[model samples]
Target: MAEYDMQELTLPNEDGKRILYPRMQLYGQKDLEYIADKVSYATSFTRGDIKGLVQAITEEIAHSMSEGYSVKIEGLGVFTPSLGLRKDKERESGEEGAPRRNAASICLRDINFRVDKELLYETAGHCTLQRAQYKKCRRSSQMFAPEERLERAKEFMKKNTFMSVAEYCRLTGLLKTTAANELKAWAAQPDSGINYRGRGTHKLYVLRPANA
Candidate 1:
């Protein structure tokens, strides 16, 4: 049986009313080996064969997506490639005579997956949900004011050269999304005492240069 719990919405609505939403209580992660073993017991294929096939299929999907092709398995779904600008490449919007972006500035941002309806229905058919006790939001950011958090972040960056979003969250007790958004906002402001290096998942926050 599957279990679920209610989580309070973090954002405020127009009426300033708090609301709760249902979220599944995950047991744990099942890796490739566990999946292979399960499939082996249900079919004639050995675990090794299943693992090899799965790996090969993943590699092929990556290769095809790199070549600008979307792959769709019968029972699975479509995997489409997505692109984004590389680090230091700003969008050429409203900038007069800015250098146009070339291939070097483009990168594979992500691969979008649209699940098949049949697979979704099949998975839903197997679920038996039971409501569990509600868990309170662990937003530690509530303990500190926004300015206090910024001071703490500046202190942290003084000793460390760079800080990842996860490290910032630990330092400020903020949720991941909140920490990331705040960091981006701070980086955008002039003399905000915070700046970021790199792009996408590799991004790291650093103290803004004194002269800049």
Candidate 2:
């Protein structure tokens, strides 16, 4: 089994109660070594890793949508870009020489992103300088397991297989943390599992067949 490191962080509430959370292990040894080696290196990063990340994303989208279902990068909604040839009637000068030559086009019929409420709320808090409120909101439960939490989550999975953790929480009103842990439990089963993409702030989960 691969061991994942975890960081214990204490976030203080307005009234001073500390909320402890295990932040997912972020940087690994290779990452630390790279950062160490480049201490003096300054690279311009506009969101920084945009280009390579975008290409990787495009490849993923192409892979998933090859058969036509829309693919979504959440916060960003679904996108269905198609490659096609452009053919139109045209006459150069008045020669009436049939139509123009072949031309190709990549059409982005839908490119959209819907900001998450938590993201929006955090941004607003920062902009308004509401540090206290922001901190309190950030500590919001998105993590507790209720009385029927597991059963409810499993039932939800039955109806909406392969949903993201946030999406599942959104639909079922489960705390984000609780939903994540539930899915983690489901994954631990030898004959049932789920997979997720992204890490830290951008994580999203998907259900997989038991055999997978």
Candidate 3:
């Protein structure tokens, strides 16, 4: 059985009225071990064998995706690889001063999954839903002008050698996605007084060097 709740929307409609939307309440996460245990109970194979098979399948899927192929499991789903710019490798072209995007600048960003219809239908058939509680929309009170936020980031970078997206979010009271996008935009502007180092998860914003 699954539980659902009504969550009030933070954003108002054109008539300036917020409405409630249905959302599923997550119970907990089930890891690979849990799946192995469940499968082992229903099959002649041991938990170790189930785990090994699952691991091997995951590795092969990753390998195939890296080689530009999407993998589809019979009753599960299709896994397609998505690409994005590698922050560290991106650079402005000297001619147009626009960022150059090519094979070198791009890397696998994420894997998108499209579940099989039959599997989804089977899961939906087994689900028994009950209403839980009503949730109110909670909006962030920390709102600052874009220019002010940029200045705040610059000031912080002056004292600290580097700042992570999480740190920037805490310092400016901005959401994670907003903070990350702002930082990336600032770093792209050569004279923004902000730059970045590293790539992907290890990326950090830093004060632009005076000479470079």
Candidate 4:
């Protein structure tokens, strides 16, 4: 097999216009099936129905945002219509405590998104496949046994003390579930890791040094 170099190519579009292509992203069929399964399991409706519903909801959100209104997608995040700032706010408390110009310039639509932790975790897990591929090219082994993967995961956590589980999975090529589980296990170690749970589905992990 020939090595594939990351390259940009010009390809013809549907209208016969040539467009520059950056890169290609391909999803495996099994991965798609797994996603379908997750959707089916998480929701009350059937998989096919939920898939269509998801697409429709996304289209609706796009349409709504295009009209300048924020559309909140459940378990995902908020999309808000944004407009450029007209003027900067004065940053003065009056005289001696006076500040100069406006503290913040440019205005944006007040849209906030709090992604569903479960969904985010699930999504982060799969991005590991891409990381795995990259690692395969650079390292001698494209294959990582479960135990090795677990050990590497621990080393990764030690190196990056503050990365989110999803980010860790992407960087380490470990599935989201695997990453989360490892974090829980690490936290279980006495005097080394912090408790990782809080109110109502909020998720976080912290590492603590025993000496400090």
Candidate 1 lDDT over residue span 1-212, tens digit each: 66677877999678999888998754334688888878998999999999999999999999999888999988899999999999888976767886788898999998999999989999999999878533323654477788898888899889998888766766666767788899999999977899999986568999999998
- lDDT, candidates in the order shown: 0.82, 0.50, 0.78, 0.54
**Candidates' TM-scores?**
0.62, 0.27, 0.58, 0.29
lDDT of 2 by residue, 56-106 (tens): 888888777766666866554566645444344333344576545443333
Each candidate's root-mean-square deviation in Å? 16.8, 22.8, 18.2, 21.8
Residue 88 displacement (Å), model 2 = 83
- The Cα error of candidate 3 at residue 144, in Å, is 34
Q: Among these predicted structures, which one has the highest TM-score?
A: 1
Off by over 4 Å in 1: 94-96, 134-212
Cα error, candidate 2, residue 149 (Å): 5.2
Q: Look at candidate 1 and tell me the lDDT of residue 129.
A: 88
Better of 1 and 2 by lDDT: 1
lDDT of 4 at 155: 63
Candidate 4 TM-score, C-alpha based: 0.29
For model 4, how does the per-residue alpha-carbon lDDT over 122-206 read when each residue is reduced to its tens digit? 7766643222233212222336664575456556557765545554454455555665676677667755444454522246554
